[model samples]
Target: MNENLTIIWEKCLTFMRDNLNAAEDNTDLKKLENSFDLLFDNVQPVSLNNNNLTLLVPSDFYKEYIEDNYLSLLSAALKKNIGKGVKLWYSVMENKPAGQEKPITMNMKGKSVATPKMQETLPPSFSANVINPFVVPGMKKIHIDSNLKADFSFDNYVEGECNKFASTVAKSIAKRPGATAFNPLFLYGGYGVGKTHLGHAVGLEVKHAYPEKVVLYLSSEKFIQQFVSAAKAHKQTEFANFYQMVDVLIIDDIQFLSGKKSTQDSFFHIFDYLHQNGKQIILTSDKAPVDILDIQDRIVSRFKWGLSAEIKSPDFDTRRKIIVDKLSRDGIVLTEDMLDYLASEVKTNVRELIGVINSVIAYSTIYKSDLSLELLKETISKIAANQKKVINIPYIQDVVCEYFGIEREQLLSKTRKREIALPRQLAMYFAKEFTNATFNKIGEEMGGKDHSTVMYACDTIKDVSKIDKEIKKYVKELTEKIKQ
Candidate 1:
């Protein structure tokens, strides 16, 4: 057994030597040896599985310490010599030994002194004390709540032309929690557009992968609230210490911090500390950092230092996918036409989109209503339409001109021409249908045409749109653009 122990120790040492770049000086080697000796004295080997070493310690304290202090070194050593894809498991043993020695002690001089027997058995090169920079001393381990959903991972995030860039950057930052590429990832988008969800998801991923890593997920408002609480309790230093030590910091709804100068100052210091220390910082807001009102220039510049991504409103296909995913999860089925109509009308936000689906499900459950397109439109109109703004006429006109390969003046001009008149009449028809405007008002906006002419154009376009596939496609595209 002693011979086997010696061989294992030699192998571990050899692995360490091959991986680490600790100074070859005698002083550094002695320190590393001492750390290993102290670690081994406290840790015991468990059963091996699949070529992985499972070392069991006596307490959570040792488990965390070993992970923080030496896990990287061990992993590096194993991967360098044993090849890639090596894994190590460090678990805490539940039962204590009958007569375990006292835990290793650090003297007033900052030297780690082992027990007498341990000192005798420990190698000469393993007697000195060495400081490990990676180990965070006196960190209070936080337990994660298991009730949080796991499906909010990067895998489930749907990428579209609108949000593909943002999604990719978010995944990269989550996978590698540090200032590798995007130091402080800034994501901004409209409400109910998944900005907060993505921020929290990144925090969950980092925390799950590296349990020892201290990740704090809080809204900017909550952060301010905590800061204020700490100030009132005269625990300002304690609060500062708590934030300064975190490994990954995620702040959601950062736009709330825009006008609060004092809060921004405190946050500036916290941001600087974590960023300077190579830690990861992620932020989400409704607008880009520059557009956020009253934010200090320094803070704004720091926010823009990393990558910026925006989550635009989802397209038709993406919205339909979201509805289908939600309905499937709830075990509710709907006809194809009904699904298409919901996706078409509830095109504003994800929250509203899902709310429409839920209302339909509720109506079916309570009223025994058959799920049909007309029924969906009625139920969805009651809830979803109230939440939606009747899209403005000028907005439609601008969107139509932008969509079609033409200028606003060209569309409004009275040429009776086929190319321009067709688009101009379609815009007038949509404006009258979508807005609470009379034909006179609509005609005036369309370059002051007569109300009769507006009525004739509207009538002509309605008939033409039904038969003209090209006109129908352009109108649909223009409607979608304005809704977004």
Candidate 2:
């Protein structure tokens, strides 16, 4: 038995040497072998009805990292050398070492005693500075800040008709920073859209592509905090200088800058400096520049100088892609039906979608069970069923009329002239499609028109939409904007 165990251990070492380039050092191999020997010494194989071999590790981090990164390779090696159908399990020992030698006996009354503890202990894998040799030399440290989450990137941003154009432009800017025709790009949209994700993606791309470039990515709240700190310390100039020096500036949630006149004034100077120097500036807010409250005209004009795009709430296809991408990254396999259900039900935002997926994964991990569509539905039903209050047609008409620089009376008028009539027809069409009102009711709401006029307006939109792609696109967008 001793000879067989020694031979098995040697075969395992040989496999490791052949398969892993990072573990090529002779000293590292010796240390690993010693650690394995120490671990196996304290864990005697149970003489049960199966041929299962369990290896004990010192920490949960060791078990998880090894399981995720190297378990399959190790199992394949074991099966290749020791015949076949060999099973292995890795678990962290619970009881602390007290120099005890407990006898491990099977139900058959056969017994094996644990070996003595090692004189030199191996370091726990979870220790702070224990570097994985496989990781890139300079990429060892991953710094996470409250304003900068590790998971916010283009990979997780869902794409739909509502936001496809904006997402595409953002990705292009990220791929080639400071090179796009639209310098100092500003993205505006409704709340819960992916404006922040696009802004963060720009920073992430810059860091990954041009690692040497100094990138300062922060939220407006962080900027306010730092600026306040600088003021308290009489170092406002220092803060300004630091912000001015970055190669790229990404500010998220710029809407928060509203009502803070002093902060906005300081920000305007920074914006001007960055814009004049050709440094890429990416800003995201919940409203368009012209609509932002209490913002200086100079700042608003500067914001509009570059291209302005908006990301609307994701549609069904985009939501599904978001779910699939997020789950795939976490190493979770979800069925098509499960993904469809999630995509259809969780239609709010990317963050909520990810939350649901995380919850499902956590439940599965905790229970030591397989993931099923039924389990996912049961887990998500409580959170997903909270219905959002549907907006009425009159509300949409009011917002749309206000947005297009048209009056409410003009929308209900029956004039067929292109300029006034086009916006009017659009209002009527939206009223018919988006609201719970009937044709007669919509026509009455428009301007005391008959039901036939409402039907004609709807038909006119459908016919024009089929013939003119540009008009169709604009109407579709207007519909989405009002709905969002």
Candidate 3:
């Protein structure tokens, strides 16, 4: 029976290779097979009856992983080779022969750690033993609530020049906690620039790469709140001790810690303990430590102990890519012109950019409007709060000519044609409205008209806009265009 089972297992492996190789595009299947080789390959097939088979694995973790992730693939491969309707099952091997070696175990860091064959149940509290928590009688081990969000991972983080350096440092800290010079990664940036996202990503990555390592992520506000609660309950020492046990502690919005002298003193001690123990720390703040006001000098000094990386406001190209990425995720398509329009208009922070895109998508859905340039302009005009820029006479002239479908030279020419006359007058009016250029300066720039002509043009447009809806619409559209 053992020999037959071995033969069937070899055939199953061959079947897996053939099927998986044929579907090379199925990367998830390929990853499952890779995990199989890393985990299930060493398992011994103990029984086989025609299409029914059973294999013995070393630990519950291995059994659970195989059952959850690869059982379907393994069964499919076995059926392809053995016969239709073949079934497979796994059982834990509780006993081992003398002199047999224990199965190798890989930790979250992907490093092999030697574990004894026999398993033991541990309490909830953490301990000094890095590999295994030291057993304590009567006192339970601490349970660390990491408070990290799973969705905020490094994989989904969009990397660009504005945050590449900070992302790199975050990834390094994730790989080897407290091993690099960046023992504590201090990330400072404007709100919505992805500092909180990056902080969460670092914690999640560290937890993934080192499952045994304790990770805790909390906002500075929450930290202060917790400290206050603990102090009120007279459990401050317990609070401090619990934090000291975490391998990686992520605190967001450290700027809020200002003016909280007691919280600062408590955190200073926790920071010192964790740093001295070679644990990793991550902090997010709106400003750098030196610029943080009302904070103790010693606390600020500790913040400056590690590398400080800043995430600046994304540039035009980066913002463009961000909008494209967002639209792609929502399966929405926009023309290059529309994308450029959005990227140009929303040049603030990432949060606001995403908010603007969401607003546009929502408006399109509710209004049942196709994503035309006109719809885009109207939506932007409605939603963009910070889209204003300093205006100039040249910009006004350009908008006027573009709106009337004429040339700058024609608008500025001596022609008295109604088409040219109206747009030229509108340009002079906007030049007076939007720019600091005096009437003389505006007239001198526009076909060398007299200052009185500029004044008369402004009055004519303003009066017509009051009673003429067509003129009002034109003025509104031109105003929105110029602002955008």
RMSD of each: 20.6, 24.3, 20.3
Candidates ranked by lDDT, best first?
A: 3, 1, 2
lDDT of all predictions: 0.68, 0.65, 0.75
| Candidate 2 Cα outliers beyond 4 Å, as residue runs | 1-148, 371-373, 384-484
Per-residue lDDT over 1-484 for candidate 2, one digit per residue giving the tens place of the 0 to 100 score: 2566667656775685566545656553443443444333444333212555555554332343344335665777767776577666543343233664632221111221232322222222212232212133356563323244456777666666767667656766766576553557788765566787778777887788887776777888978887776678665554566565667888888878877887777787777767666688988886667656666777777786557886756668988887788778878888888888888876655666677778877887898777677887777775545635456655666566655777555665667778777777777788878888899877756666778988998889878998999778868888777755
Give candidate 3 regions above 4 Å deviation: 1-142, 367-369, 385-484
| Deviation from truth (RMSD, Å), model 3 | 20.3
For 382-431, candidate 3 gives per-residue lDDT tens digits of 76455555577756776677679886668778889998999998898888
Overall local distance difference test of candidate 1 = 0.68
lDDT of 1 by residue, 1-484 (tens): 2455346645765676544445556553444454566656776645344656556566444553454446677666556544576456554443233476533322111222322211112122322223211224344553323222467666556555557657656766766787344768898866677887777778778877888887777778878887777667655555565666678888889989867887787787778767766799989986667656668888888886566777867879888888888787778787888778888886556766767778888988898867777777788767754675548765677567756677656776778788888889888988887889899878766766779988997888778779999877877877677665
What lDDT score is found at residue 94 in candidate 3?
Answer: 40
Per-model TM-score on C-alpha atoms: 0.52, 0.50, 0.52
Candidate 2 backbone collisions, by pair: none
Model 1 scores a TM of 0.52
For candidate 1, give the lDDT of residue 449: 79
